[model samples]
Target: MTASVLLAADNLGVHVGTRALLRDVSFSLRAGEVLTLLGESGAGKSLLAQAVMGNLPAALRASGSVTLDGTTSRADDARARRPRWGRTVALLPQEPSLALDPLMRIAPQLSETHELVRGAAFDQAEAAALHDLEAAGLAASARQYPWQLSGGMAQRAAAAVACAGGARILLADEPTKGLDALWRDHTVAMLQGVQRRGGCVVVITHDLRVAEALGGQLIVLCAGQVVERGDARTVLADPQHAFTRRLVAADPARWPRRAAAPASAGAPVLSAQGLSKGFGGKPLFDGVDLQIRAGDRFVVQGPSGTGKSTLGNVLLGLMPADRGVVRRAEGLHATAFQKLYQDPVASFAPQITLGQSLRDVAARHRCAWPAVLQHLSRMGVPHDLLARRPSQVSGGELQRVALARVLTVQPALVFADEPTSRLDPVSQQEAMAVLLDALDERGAALMLVTHDDDIADAVATQRWRLAAG
Candidate 1:
């Protein structure tokens, strides 16, 4: 197959405050091809995408030539190069929930894109947009608001809008991070269809399974530099760089198994009987029951929009259940959600440091701040990282900080919803190890919500499948 370059980044460099996020990074995407950007958390993967999209923060300074179809321009100039977006390029951000407007219907968004890109009239554009929506697996979601649609459905609608705009290059960041196997597979297939239609796709992801399934050219990044670049199978099966090899080796599926938990246990530390949650007449969880005893790691598995997150919310008292009762130990509970609830830029108080955030949570639970610092160090989070504000830290670092905050609480029961979704394989393994160790030491019970079977198999002492009732 003939290769035609669609986009290229030459010697891309970006600096956020005093920290150099990315430097001397270079890669290219071509029509009829999918290029996978593989990296751990905080490796500047997302920054690279934002830079490409001309959406980098104003505080950060960048120097690079991002070229589209043979036109080279500076970051500012490139952003202003219109007829650029929805025509030459498009972006599908990491979280569909954040990308979509909750109040707007999907069909209108597509129609707007058609009008903006193709100058089509309202009636003509609506018809063309509906056709594109159907092709993108969003036919049923045309009139649905973002909140009314599932994550997968919203993502599909977003892609349809991009397609309708006649974009030739698509950039997707962790597109399937929080989705299940079926949705993950379906999303990838939809992207592949884009490539087949003669467009180029660039996917920034931490999941090796996604890279493997997409069958793309793989480029590995670590600490803001390219470590490996080649065919997906070649790079994964026989990695040349030490970092690449370490990532492949760190897969949770490859972890050594621990002794199984005793089958017969004492009274359950947490229990839910006939839990049901619904919204706007749509039942999220019809009737789900689960039990967790001390030392038990129970995994709740299901596809996206199947109530995995709703179940977590119900457990945390953030959302009330319509029916059934959830009983927990008479103590504090800590949770880490699938999406980063805390603002990446301002999760910490402006006057306080990262260390203070940890200390505050520790003080609330009457725990020692020093002990929390020790745990953070053991988890590979530098002590100095505690001095940085959320705005200054990377996403991975922020997540680690959040995990540290949770640990300081010393809760009797913990609920983690896709805790490793945004983490790289190495960080994922490290975080899981710390969580399991702390739980084991405390003899606390855990209810983990995730779709990654490897994570479920690695950490779960018992497992339950939740389906739409």
Candidate 2:
């Protein structure tokens, strides 16, 4: 690699014992430019970033030459690599909440990081932190704790922290994972801000639209191998590899799938009349009316931090509605109601294996072990995954398992909150098809809550959009 290239990874490879996770990966990123790494799930995108940061999983062994600026650091040099992390290379972590101190406010956390990384005085760090938050479009969230900010706001805060370190090379992972269109656009602009300042950005994402938005060189990886590499427009317009073609064509809007068919109206099977909910003396949504018949795909679409999830809870009687009543069929039992939660890790006990969790669901719903296994198999989940815990498997695999566990109930109505949030594009399409087919076979009514416009359009039989206010 030449001296002009700011960050270069040459022949980088990662292996867990004998199993290769990343093979012969090579790329270079320069200042005032952005590089996009496009790949499906399990393509070692995150692992590559870990290797560059000199901190990978404990089980994995990295073999590669990572050069940041003019200094080269070997992957095994733990001591020598420590000083270069926040000083020369910084990471915009995927989960901001996990990265930040939960007990501290955003300002304090950013200021502390600035003080440590930039060696600034307390007053200087505080001023710089506020400026970074403003640049991140989160000035109002300076005093708010991590728990108080919305998903989009929290992501911006994380970006601000990475930038405040004054590192020349910035790495962002899935920067717009769960954002609405407005927030997604804003985030695009925020990432562009770094480029405007002549810094280098390497973005790791599976979303083709996000890759196109960043307008950079594209490197497509599959099965720990680089399958294609080219300019963004050239690659998207004319993909040479089959895998790249599939990714380019994985457009939910252009997919040949029918919208959820509406059920003929009679007596409403489920009805919410004048539903109102509030938090902290502020009304989230009020005077909302909804009705669901058999086979109804009721989509609750809105921006993040809206009352979509709360509305789902109220309808399921998990939480009380402030000024309304949810009337369901009088004879509906607990078996008739089920929920497919967003975060499967939080849903299951960490100590228990996925096999044990599935067994519990099977017993509660009177489903046979064979039937549960069949459900998991249909969602592209291998049987061996049953022996693993939530942490042992990927978030995508956990999502599929979560779907299978809930489907074993065979409910009359299902509440799916961001069910496909963790899945890659190809897996997302496959998983959604499986979910829709399962629901259709049983004629189950679905109340789906999400911020993705494409997902909202793909599955919505009827749309109920909540206000940001």
Candidate 3:
């Protein structure tokens, strides 16, 4: 007998007026199986996912019927909500910090979400919340607020929320966006747990590592159309579509050649001596020392909650270290320091337009308008997109804009915290190459924090791994 279809979407199309974002997307997902929608940025992966969940934005129009385990709904309903579907469907949203209530503690939040999704008693949900946290690699994050989480931690906690209510059909958008290997493994196990319970999962992701880890039927989308659909191993080993080939090739894991880092020459630009930091009297690292010389690509790597992000802040003088000093040598590149955060949205001003943000950064260094425009053009940002807010742009586009913002400043030291984590492999490769090449041209230093080992291997002249507490 054929596997039962848990969800089916037919002739789905999304458009804003005349422009089509997605068209003719049709797929049926079987229960207990994982179906991954794989594509590059703006390739209509997320749009299709949202369409299936009946969560399209107001301005866009969706023509489709989404059937969930027998109940069907129109895709264009703005009132489409999670609770209305209840345990029949659940979504692990794309941005964890945005998905959560910043004022509430994570424990209570998880319990509440569990109760809402599963229709369980509050007491039972509260008692079982720890298990969800543990599954998401956040046993200690129960009492923490959304603002306190690292990008990776927030992603995991969001996973906990998506799975908390035992929803049989899981719709996750880039669920492993900021996670490291250890936590990523845990997430994979969590998904498997759902499968073991005879549930279905549909994941939208740019990272091939996620697809490989989950072992699913892969559906490749490019420019709003499905180009290829096949078993994971067959398609991954030999993709039938050019877009799929490009995506598969762009993965640093599959890259045959890599650029060699320039020799670490000249005087040390930044030095950390016996640097140690802690929260609530617990030390994250002790007696840690390192020197970043001119042109050195220093890669800091660790699993989730290993204090890698904290280390970046402490080194950049944004936060105080409890035990040591971060020394900087004066008189170098035009701008002394700049950082690209894991989540660029937080770095952007809510009221500021994208163009203004770039110009503001440039003006800080006495940069000219012509130079700013030149940089913006090189980054492939249209003049029209400049007027939009950060929230209006896609994650990949926002990241590229952030890169444009930093490069225009021409800083001597570049600190990139998970710079390309959310980008599709093609975009990730392109963005990192641009950042590294720009740094080289200006004789700058880099302190890159990433969970991607392939990235560290490709870019780092030296590597540092922080131990988990």
Candidate 4:
């Protein structure tokens, strides 16, 4: 008997203006199977998902066939595919925070989806959808607004909504990004459960470990074309193509180890005493105190909802503390936030090139532009990228650029929040090495917040845990 194909994209192509985002891409998803799309940033992973969902932007054009339930069609047939769209294929985009509305309650969004997709009354479907939420590990989140939920909770809620709609084929873009290890494992298990129930799932990610964990089948994409496709384990273990080999070789878990302790003694660079923060009659952190000496690579680790990122924010002055004090012995400090808040396209003034942005930041701190450019080179950002606007760069490049800007300021203390969460393993290593080396030269202190143990173990001179009581 022939295997059933739940979804298939044959010879698909997508073009944004004159640039071809994806070309001649082909893949298929079967019931009870997961096909992970692995590639670096700018490899068209998200764009492929959009093309499959018929949600490509207005400026882009798509060709070839995207078939659901064995029915093949072009862009013009999108309307005909509408009724079966959400029910047959559901998409979970990157950045759940942006995906959800801050003002809307979770239940209302579910009710609205049910009404629009199934033509069912809100009251009628509320009970069943809540059951779905419970199964998806979001039982108590019904009444909460998006902002009220933790990052992991919000991602799970988004997944619950997709599954609750009875979608047979799930397209998840970076589903585990920014989640703690516990939540990441749980989310992957839930998706596996979906596959066990005879559903099809496709996960788009740059993290090879995520793909390895969700083993079924794999398709490696580079520059919009498939470079390798086979059993997940086999492809990863013995990759043939140069790009695939490089990806497998670049796993952060396999990176070379660096001595955790610094050889030199230096003065205390940063100190915090009796740090405390509370919200809604509950304490997020209580009397948390820590100090960092020069040459120290300190790491802060914690589970979701435990306020690790919150503590980072308070230290960086992005958010204020309810009580206690944070003091930096050195006047210079730079921070890379866990979440990307600034508009990438407008991160720098439209009129200014990327190089100018770097120069402006360097000048503000009395650093020379030549030194800044050299620093950027060490971070693997070519001078050509400096001539381009932030909008012209991919998410990973944009993040590196942001870090480059921070480095240009020549800070004596640096705080990096989940800096490698969205970066591919190779880029993560390169970025970390550059940042650490620069800090060492300036005798600066480093404070890193992350969920990855490998990262904590590799770079930290001191490690601390935040527990949820």
Candidate 5:
């Protein structure tokens, strides 16, 4: 007998105060099937997932029917689905840093999910948790807190915990955002494992490689409307819609090699010698030395937990090196060095609107508010987004806003850590262009940390690789 439809949504719509964010979206999923949502940033992809899960924010309202395992409920009635959470449904949020509890150890978090949510015994839970961590290649980090793990490692841990409850219906939002190729494939395998167990998955992502790999059903959204829907491979291979075509073409693999020349001859912006860093008595990287010149683009490339971010922090003086000296050029303002953080939400004040945060930065830098607005415009950030707090906006939108904030300071050097990982291909290209253009205009140097080889190839004048020692 054919497997019954495990999940179905009908005429789903999401809105805030009559302003529709998502409209008339519908789909169904069966056991062993995967449904992937693809869209540009702020195109209501996440909102749709929230709608289906009955997890929309308080200000938003959802209208539709959500059917799970022959039971139907109002899409907006979150309470109706609360009991099913962690049992029948699970959501792997986009930002692992925020999703994982800060104070809890990774192993304990996984153990709790298995014991409490899955009704496993404590001993069984502990063993299962360790096994999960090992599968995610985080066995050594099982005892560590979320903050101690690198972004990619944390992403893996979060995935493990999300799946620990034995939830058959998984909603994974950008699950592979910060991962390297190995881990990316591993995550894809994990999702496939869910399918092999007769479960279904709903994934929201901008990663075409992931969408292509999942290869079940694909829905491309634009401005909250379905622009294209079909088999993932066929649609991506020969897109029919204009937006879909642009999205597919915007992949970094297709990007032309940059013609920009190295500015190594320019005056040094910063220099470091004999840099070393480690965690828990294990060295991540050791004895690294480098110099960054004005107008240079330096890329820090490495696998997860190899200390790419640690090196950036050490060079930026945000964190001290175990054994090194970093020298900055004289006559530069204290804010001459700014960083576009990997997690943009952490950089802003949670309680304040984005506008207020930008105003404060502008005031500190003696820049006009209009100048900040102009920078936001250059980065394609909407003016209305300024009214919301950092968590209220989409990740891609928040990332662009962060870059715009960085540019307002006219920094002499920028440490952009995986800055565009959350963005769709089209927005990724645009954001990179804006950043490079702004940096070139100001003759500023850049130290970028990313796992994307295409981006490194497209932008870096110099490359640095870190390996665990």
Candidate 6:
């Protein structure tokens, strides 16, 4: 007998006033099945997830019906489904930093979810929480606060909390964003575990590898409409839509290798000596010496929790090393040193519109507004998005805007901490092009952290590999 549908969305749409962000999006998932949503940045993929979760932003409106476990409810009435959030339906948000509570530690958060949402006893909840963290390879991070863990660690922690409620239907949005290849595979396996348990999973991601791995249903969206829908393996292997083809082609693994930029023969823009750092008494790296010359591209690669981001922060002078000295070239404006954070949303002022934030950056750095506009245009970011606050826009959109803002300062060096992690394949290519082009024009140096080996190979003039200490 055919299994019943566990989750279904009928003619779902999202809007802000008269502007349609998503239109007529629909899908259905049964137990032991997976549904993957694929699209470029700002293509309404996340909006669709929010519509089904009944968690759309207050400013935006949703329309349609969502059926879960044989109960149907209007998508727009968020309150009607509030009680279903954890045990029935759970959403693993795109930004783990924002999803986690700053004041709380990791283990307790999972335990609480199990206790409150799943109605498990205190002892069982605590044990289950520990087990979940261990399975996610975040056992060491169990005692750490969300802010204390690295971006990848926090992401895994967030996944544990999201699933602790034993929800039958999971909506995971970019769940593997900052994870390394090993952890990425681990996350996919975790999702597969959901399938083994006869639960349904809906994943929204730009990673083709994920969709191909899941090998279930796939839906491709473009400009707020479904351009294609079919089997994941079949569609990804032979995409009919032009946009889908471009997306598939844009994967970094398929990109042609370019000769790395030649070593610059000039004064070093930044230098560090005998650098060492650690987290929670664990040494990440030690006695690391480095020199970054103008126009040089340095890519840092390592497994998740190996302190890839910590090294970047240390080099950028954002955090002090346990033992190290960093020297910058004299006479360079402090503003000339900039960073693109791993989490772009946290970098912007949440209360203000994106336009106001960019305007402030332009004013502070004395960059012409026209230059900002030009950067935005070149990156394919529409001007109308500027009116929205940071949280109102898509993660990929905000990442590009962050890059544009960084370029406005004309920085002498950029410490890019997974700047393109949130972007789609196409947008990743475009954004990287703009960034490298701008850096080449300005002769700026870049120290980048990335989990994508293909991207690191394509972009790096030099490589820095960190090991777990």
Which pairs of residues have clashing backbones in candidate 2?
none
lDDT of 1 by residue, 112-207 (tens): 889978789989999998888777666756888976765456666766665677677888887777677887887788789879988888898888
Superposed Cα deviation of residue 269, candidate 3 (Å):
1.9
Q: Give the total clashing residue pairs for model 3.
A: 0
TM-score of each: 0.88, 0.91, 0.93, 0.87, 0.98, 0.98
Flag regions of model 5 displaced more than 4 Å. 1-3
- Root-mean-square deviation of each candidate, in angstroms? 3.5, 2.6, 2.4, 3.6, 1.3, 1.3
The sequence of per-residue lDDT tens digits that candidate 4 reaches over residues 151-251 is 66677778766766778888998788667778888889978987998899999877777888999889888877788899998899899999888888877
Residue 167 lDDT in model 4? 82
Ranking according to TM-score, highest score first? 5, 6, 3, 2, 1, 4
Model 6, 389: alpha-carbon shift in Å?
0.3
Looking at model 1, report the run of 10 residues with the lowest lDDT sum: 336-345
Clashing pairs in 4: none
lDDT of 5: 0.90
For candidate 6, give the lDDT of residue 103.
91
The ten-residue window of minimal lDDT in model 4 covers 335-344
Give the per-residue lDDT digits (tens) of candidate 2, residues 58-143. Answer: 77788878888877777655556668877788887655655678799999999998899899999999999998888766786788
lDDT (tens digit, per residue) of candidate 3 on 124-242: 89978988787666787789998888888898887888787777888888888778877777777888888889888888888787798787788998767889999877798899899
lDDT (tens digit, per residue) of candidate 5 on 70-163 = 6788898888888898899899988897679999999999999999999999999999999999989999998899999898999999999899
Candidate 3 similarity to native, TM-score? 0.93
In model 6, where is the ten-residue run with the lowest total lDDT? Answer: 257-266
Each candidate's lDDT (Cα)? 0.76, 0.80, 0.81, 0.76, 0.90, 0.90
Error of 3 at 244 (Å): 1.0
- Better candidate number, 1 or 2, judged by TM-score: 2
